[model samples]
Target chain A: MMAVRSTFGRTGNHPDILAGLVFIVVGALGLWAGRDLRVGAAAMMGPGYLPLIISSLIVFIGLIVTIMGLVRDNERLDVIRLRPLLIILVAVAGFAYAAESLGFILAAIWLIGVGSMADRETRLREVAASIVVLTTFGILVFIVGLGVQMKLGPF
Target chain B: MEFLDSLILGFSTAATPTNLLFCLMGALLGTLIGVLPGIGPTATLAILLPITFFLPPLAALIMLAGIFYGAQYGGSTTAILVNLPGEASSVVTAIDGYQMAKQGRAGAALAVAALGSFFAGTVSTLGLAIAGPALATLALSFGPAEYFSLTIFGLLCATVLASGSVIKAIAMICIGLLLGMVGTDVNSGSERLTFGATELFDGVEFVVIAVGLFGIAEIIVNLETPELRGLIAAKISRLWPTRDDFRRAWPAVLRGTGLGTFLGILPGGGATLSAFSAYTLEKKVSRDPRRFGKGAIEGVAGPEAANNAGAQSSFIPLLTLGIPSNAVMAMLLGAMTIHGITPGPAVIQNQPELFWGLVASMWIGNAMLLVINLPLIGLWVRLLTVPYRLLYPAILLFCCVGVYSVSNRAFDVALAVGFGFLGYLFRKAKCEPGPLLLGFVLGPLLETNLRRALLISQGDPSVFIQRPISLALLVAALGLLVLMVVPAVRKTREEAFVDEES
Candidate 1:
């Protein structure tokens, strides 16, 4: 317990409690979602049956985690960092949206350009160089070599 | 005699120019990604899985297998040079390995790691050749009750070995099982949780989850840390280790190989646990334990050997019983399924060429890695200086293309992006995703076996306890659970992981 406390001692919040609560909420949500499925008997189990059992088990474990959280004062939750997380997510999302309509070259260019923003040291010239190199590689590897039937350019 | 014949046949198959070329490509690619920060084998395999569609099945399987073990070799190189483990299995390598680099013995450390890994890989390959067919015969006798029990044991053991919070690991496994239950029910042919989408009918693609969680989530986590941190740029001294260093490392390498081979054969025991346990064992057995964290060559040799051996031996369960011991094996199993080959006892009988060839290629791949890595160490070090800003975007683009290529569906790409966010959230919540992945891969099999066992027994759950093998497995699982609950043992486990975390 002291080890747990020391590990989480930095933030002074009850991370275990938060983690426990998150698990519980997720479990409950899963159970609620799986409720419509039929829970057949053990002899001939239905698809919903295992979900109901597993989700409840998760909730039980979550309860134990919550109890541990309350009894022990331990490490606090880390402050969430939005910059890197957001930039990466947005970059991937942009590529996903653009790749179909915009073609591989443009989609890849957009990805490198925006993803470079995640690092403060990133320069326009570096991003441009990366874009040129990666797009060509992607074309040769994915299309020419692997024979993936994707558009070569946005024509 | 049969083993020798098959091995010869395997060598013949694997030595073909096409197979050798594929193996080389896989090893090179595996090392490339493994040396790069933020891209592990799991992500690389997932992103590259689509390429298998274009290759012959045997070549594809051989290549994928090469990537799996080759990554272990590269992961150790990074651990030695950069103090950052390229994969989870190399976490302990970073401890003594980085210290060695700092002490200007980086070249020695890298050589020891590669040589140790090579030795382990060769030994494990031999073990696989001898033991794989025997284990497959043993698996031929397993019934549904036994299979279900085996999965239970595997899941429980994984939970026990998981880094933090047993309850959380169990929760993750449950969540994984739930997610796996998505799509139409195979039995009744009715949709279970598809929510009326046609894509949902096929269920979630494993590639999407793999890329999102391992690939995309890693990028986000890495990005949170400072982009330009201090790396211990030790001068590359002589590439070869001294006689004294060799003498010290060989024994640890042999011992670690032995330990790892044994552990790798067990369900839920794989490279990561073997490496950690090997390190602990070395610390215990060493005459001067204090020298361990201060650049002991034994530390690098033992864990590197153990992880590589463990990585190879982990293939045992997958080939013999058609059960994956870890995420990488799970991905391989998925790939095999896509190629219309169901992995199980029948594989030895049905696909001897593929099986023996893959086993033989592993040895060849091991040799290839030893040759490929030592000469390329300087190149990999150069790769380390490539800015994460540029590296990550290329990875992201590849991930996008990879997912898109799977079905020519933008939906899967979108799905990967969504899971990437969830994966980041899970990491923040202090949940380890390993058990979740194991559960996800094994979920359907677990469910199938569970239902089958019950159906056979007419609703009697006692069948699990009635069968001797099943009973034994469950008892062992129960004992493991009890051990986890025992405060003292739990503390020791936590300490072991904590030591690695530092």
Candidate 2:
């Protein structure tokens, strides 16, 4: 699974290594947490028992997945693209925050417009036109017909 | 005759102006989304589910079912014309299909696929009509123990269906089940895995995961691979298969129908598998196997037919047993439950009209798909010609609006975004989302039945073994696992799994 990298003077195994380590550690933590529940009398299987079993299974699976990933050398996990992902992430968070104040229709209109504009290819005119047409339809369908009363922004 | 009479009532219900209109509309939309890469039936249905809130349950279901199977037809259109299979089932279509397109026979490939799917749709609906009641009647006697064992069997079969590595597939499923456990524990009313987030209390919504993973992740992957942008083949004329093409394809159709009918019955891995199996089966049975992947008409026709039939027949098991055979079917089942239909053995008996009405509508939708797609092959090809960068943004917008309209919860939209990342990870990990979805949707039911079975047997684990039918099913499950693992069978298994890579 060792793939040759042209640069960095070292194998960039950080991604898989970190993920594998996380799984193994999380599995251990789960096992420790789940170990104490009562096994129950005659026929009752304790909830903790299942968690225990499941945690162990996860640990085993995670270990295998991690090692296999390392061995396969099938992919190269690029450093996290902070710039674009950050914009999309913030926009989605904005979408949630807007849902209440602006209401479903208005918030959605903004969400679509803003989200699309984040990408360079989107045009302002197209976004504005789409906002009008689609929002009008959304308001009629969800608010008027379905009776969901999610608030729109300050009147 | 009684079956015939109820079927007549079904026609009466389905043939109504609104129902037929919705059926046609459903097929139209289904094809549209299917033709577009990255948009599958589950996300499309989830987005449109809110619209159903305004309709009668029957009409809502008819429309939703149309979206589900209708997408299957649309899926192949793109897979053939473009190198991309819009969904897993259509992957087989892309094999010989893209070959044909490359060789200037794009028209023939499109004709063969659309026709083969139409043929399967007709036959499988007939299969559903004749076999559903019989299956339901048989299912009437399943005790809690049997169902619990059957659920286990279903989970086990998922490993058999997974590609690359079966172990990873099962591991993903285990993770899926654990994730499913994040919400409230219904029976005990205990907080199990919430870890305090209010969002976790409600558990992860299926739509969020489906949309994010399938819809959003596809975008990221597409962005990564520049080689996979648009339909690379040149333009073609009228939608007609040649005489030689027809002669080669007819047998493939029959073979595909057989594969589709049975695999479609297996939950979670139907259309994708059916199509591929149809291709490989045609190849193995062919007089010249070398022609298999090299623009062979039989290769394209068989899998397309089988995949379509498999998509259609998958409904039989789910409708009869309340067991979701796959993610899309599970989503449909979820939609059904939201409409207050308890989908189990009694669904057929309690709602015969609803059940048969849906069956009849499949025929209608299939017919509509053929009409819409064949004459409009050029139209769909033109649609593929649209730059994906432009096309994908509109779909993303649809997803936003669709989610917002449904619950009117921005939180849901955020969930979709989060899932998009998760879907990316899944793609990176090389796990098929279908089986994971099966695990998620079926988790609660499987848990409930396992608990009930335990209660019924008073904790006797032998109940599963004691019942002959359950024993048979469990044995079959073990056999399936063995078949999947045997070294001698490994080559055959890969071929089957490849067909489903759609």
Candidate 3:
């Protein structure tokens, strides 16, 4: 048992600890946000009735998980690579803002162009070609054929 | 006689020109994506959910069903040839299938897998047609108290069957329930957790959550991990399996079909669980278990059949009870809601055409997959060379546009970005997102029924214990909870999942 304990890394169950923290934070947030809503009796449930119960249950589970994490053998978390995560998110967020205002063409180009950069091996020529092709397809299929409400351009 | 007439009506509805065309398109597209690694059927369905709005309800459902079962067939193709299981359900097939390929028996393995899957699909489709009406009729007699207890049972069973820490899965379900309460309450007519967002007054769209979590998060994870591409090393010698191989495969196929059909009906049980269980059963019952993982034909045949059968039968619960068993079924539920078709016991009585039409189309779709997978094997293998760098941009574009199309507003898309980030965090925490989805879909039903039951009983919690069915369901749920606490059962459960990882 001692030998097995040494095999684990310095950090103690990082994944479980992180998971517990997330549950606690989300549960607390739910409680804070819905605090104003009435928690009526079981006979007449208000909007906050189930929400409050579920939120409290979440917090309870979080406490158990956190406690377990402290007692269990140690295990390190996976290395977090922020490059792809951030790049993909920014690309999607940009498209969300651009899709309605700037229209499908620009949004498609921005999405594909910037989205391609999430990978390190992406090339300039491929990105440009994808933007051209995907934009044309989006215009023809989504805009013309499917009758999506978005405009072709900002004009 | 009535069953025959209903089936005939089903065939007539499914055999229509437009439905046939859509069904064929769905099968081909399902095969295309299923053969590709990094894209599963759930994400594919989520991305394409909005596009189906352009199609009629029956046509759309037929196409989606086609994609699902067609994926089972296509997944086995790559598993046999390239040692890469395109779908999670096919992971077990790669064990002996790749070995068969190395022994220059790739064609036999591929043929056996396709044929066995087709057989299993037919049987499960028949099972769905028979069980759907009977189960729906039984459900019609249920009251609010019964439904509340049933939902509790279903939710608890889902956490148990799912591969993870049961407590964590339950917590995720609670989080999902909390998220479901974000919109205006139906009873009180007051916003609960909108946080002053006007767009959220109507509630968060299911498509937004699905696309953000399954679609966007999956891509980011895929990018973070290095790609593993296996080369197809063996030549195809013959397309037909030997008589001895057929004899060995048939009994396994029969056993697999029976097991898959039963498992698929359970909560949180689908192709992945069914296939894993069937493989384990086959290994246990084999006369010489050492042949497994060393070109054993039964190894490929059993799991291939089980996954296909399980995929088809999982639709039974959703079609009959309006309760989705897995994430894919949840997507189907969302699709049904979008088309203004409420899936429940009334669906069979009121919209008989729709229910029967979907059942019949599944059979047609399975037949189409057999034809598509066998002859077009080379085409799908060629597609494996299409690098993720080129593919992901297209997927990212589709996901963005799909979410925007749901409400024709960018707000939903923006909201999905937040979910995408949260989904990434959940992945880092090693939490499975599947239970969260099931919880979100069932939360409203659970709360509504619980409120009604309590209201009728004048706040008496004993109403749950008073009803016979409700008492039985709650007791079963309690039993499952107790079983999970037993140290021996917990160890075996852990061991069962550990087998899949290796």
Candidate with top TM-score is: 3
lDDT of 1 by residue, B1-502 (tens): 8878998889999999999999999998888877876777887787777768778998998899888888898888888888878788898998899998998899999999999999999999899988999988988899999999988898887778657888788888888888898898898777766666788788888778888888889888887766543475587878899999999999999999999998888766778888999999999999999999889999999999999999999999899888887778878887887788888889998889888999999999999999999987888877877767777777777788888888887778888988898788788778877777878888999999999999999999999999999999999999999998899999898887885543
* Cα lDDT, all candidates: 0.84, 0.73, 0.90
- Per-residue lDDT tens digits of candidate 2, residues A1-155? 11232243244343454445445665665566445444443255555545566668878977876776666554555434333344455556676777767666556666566656545556778777767866676577656767665664545
DockQ of each: 0.57, 0.33, 0.76
**TM-score of every candidate:** 0.93, 0.89, 0.98
Candidate 3 lDDT over B265-331, as tens digits, reads 9988889888998999999999999999999999999999999999999999999999888888988
Query: What is the descending DockQ order?
Result: 3, 1, 2
TM-score of chain A of 3: 0.90
Return the clash pairs for model 3, or none. none
Which of 1 and 2 is ahead in TM-score?
A: 1
Name the regions of candidate 1 deviating beyond 4 angstroms. A1-14, A152-155, B99-104, B228-233
Indicate the TM-score of model 2: 0.89
Candidate 3 contains a number of clashing pairs equal to 0
Name the better of 2 and 3 by DockQ.
3
lDDT of 3 by residue, A1-155 (tens): 10111234575787888789899999999999899999999998888888899999999999889888867888766667778888999999999999878988888888998899988889999999999988899888988999888988889
